[model samples]
Target chain A: MSLNPLHEIHTRRFSRNLGLGLTLGAFIAIIFGLTIVKVSRGDYEPPRAPTATEATQ
Target chain B: MSDVSINSPEFTGQGFEGEAQFGDFFALLKPRVMTLVVFTAAVGLLAAPVPVHPFVAFCAILFIAVGGGASGALNMWWDADIDAVMKRTARRPIPAGKVTGDEALAFGLTLSAFSVVFLGLASNWFAAGLLAFTIFFYVVIYTMWLKRWTPQNIVIGGAAGAFPPMIGWAVATGGISVESVLMFCLTFMWTPPHFWALALFIRKDYDHAGVPMLTVTHGRRSARNHILVYTLLLAVLAIATAFTSVGGPVYLVVALVLNALFVKGAYDIWRRDEDVSETDNFSVEKKFFKLSLLYLFAHFGAILIEAVLTRMGMGGWT
Candidate 1:
């Protein structure tokens, strides 16, 4: 008996898979871009170290 | 007998029918409605006094569009029953059997949560909260409660569609102001007359679907009178907006011309009886409906131009 590797369901659902893949990829790109913008804008900066004068005070 | 034959009773018993494609899922988002969302939101963002980074602005609009699309999915999910009955909506994804109601519900809820969270992270919580409220209002308040119960459904439900610009403004300004309120008012006021004109042309769809549209409950002449009255009120609000911070000389001119045409259209709709409308195949009503679309786009476009010119130091009277 010969074995077939491809299934008909795969062909029928290819477009849906591709679309979901593209949508997820785009979401990742948006997140990366947003992270860069927020970081560059100091939105996620750690709190600054206290100065000795301030610490003494 | 071939096991792969789709026509076989065995294959039919396996229950693979009307399998949705990528386009079907996208249709669940109501892309046509998203265009209005994207446009109005962009206008609100740009028309604000503060400047946003281009990429950030892009993110804000994208998330707002997603939020709007999420609401559309929810609307389709909830209204699948009515949609199946109405000629205008019978072909929607859920009603047409391409996408199941459960699938639509899951899709809508997921996108709603994602959009609200991402919008809060991308811009501000105020805008995100507004978007969240908008989804709730559209899905719950309007779709679930108001739509089937009252003839004033469109009047109140219009608020859902009117919110994008306000969300856009809040994204930029991080708060609401008179400017954002005015923009919201502009869309809010324009919606009733716009929809009533459509109801005039497709009254039977609502009648058959058992939806309490103004035309269904109040009657055609009453709907016409409502259209005229709303158009007059909308014209006053629209023209008054020309003096606000978002408006300029260009907007004033556009508003003047468009309002005149809109009022004329409404008047024409009001003057005609059903006999005349039927004779002309509702051509005047159809023309009015088309003009309503142009009226909105032109108004927002003019505001966008004013914003651009203001940035260039050539915009408003100031």
Candidate 2:
């Protein structure tokens, strides 16, 4: 084998690690999907100001 | 300096040394730490009362992650000297001579400026401000000032890691709240005990590196005592969190079970003898450390589940 600098002196695990990175990206996409679906369906309401009973002791 | 090939694509000039690979640059980002930052920050964002636009939320998380990677890079650059000494860290990009310290410093600073500026534009200024402070705390306070100065380094340094959730919360609400503060406190309190467990096994590394970890300054017995005390406090805080706005049946159950197991693990560590025999091998300490990872993830996972359920209108006290 030709002595390639990349193969020696440093570790390489790009394919496996890249697979894991994509999985993380997919997970983030799922969370984004959920947030969009919830908001578009009008399922989420903005929080309201505290009521008198809630604000008081 | 030794590996600098004059014509290599990885070489940039006077400073660039060695055939720097993609993994080398990625290592500087400290992806493992970034994972925790992203996961906890996501939970904090989802658990907040206010709803965030999905695209905006994505931008917020992406910037927060970049900021987190910035902190890790800065930490590596600053801690490279000590990292070179520790057996566990001897092969890092800097110590292994894969990347020069100067390059790491530039990489960290560029990412820091990039992440903070874009975060301010993408999210509220408050969240972006917290990100900036988090980076400063990790690099300046924790890595530089605290690590070598005192045994309580991890205790104070833990705050840097704890800020991600609060930053995530600010992304949604544009301000702080009781829930966000509680989440920060949970991570802060859990850090010492979690780290000290690893310290029990690796105490010799800190001793050799001259880092004043609690295990190095205090004896093994004292470290065990501190872990027990901290674990008790952590259990109380975690269980109490189950009753807060983010809490529900799902969270309550997870909290009860995990806290019980955690306390049991701490107690087991405390009861361990100072000396390790052939059969002992520090497995108890390692097992506790492993469980501690699960402990945090389980709590955050529970919180995320509660948020999803609430979004579906099937959650909260009912």
Best by TM-score: 1
Model 2, span B1-318: residue lDDT tens: 344453455434433436466678779898988899999999999999999877777778878998999889888898899899999999989999988899899989989998898778666788889999999999999999999999999999999999999999999999999999999999999999999999998867899899999988888889999999999999999989988989889999999999999999999999888675225889899999999999999999999999999999987687
lDDT of 1 by residue, B183-252 (tens): 8888899999999999998878999988899998989999999999999999999999899888989999
Q: What residue runs in model 2 are displaced by over 4 Å at the alpha carbon?
A: A1-57, B1-17, B276-278
Off by over 4 Å in 1: A1-8, A49-57, B1-14
TM match of model 1 to true structure: 0.94
lDDT tens per residue, model 2, A6-27: 6433343344367568857975
Clashing pairs in 2: none
State the lDDT at A57 in candidate 1: 100
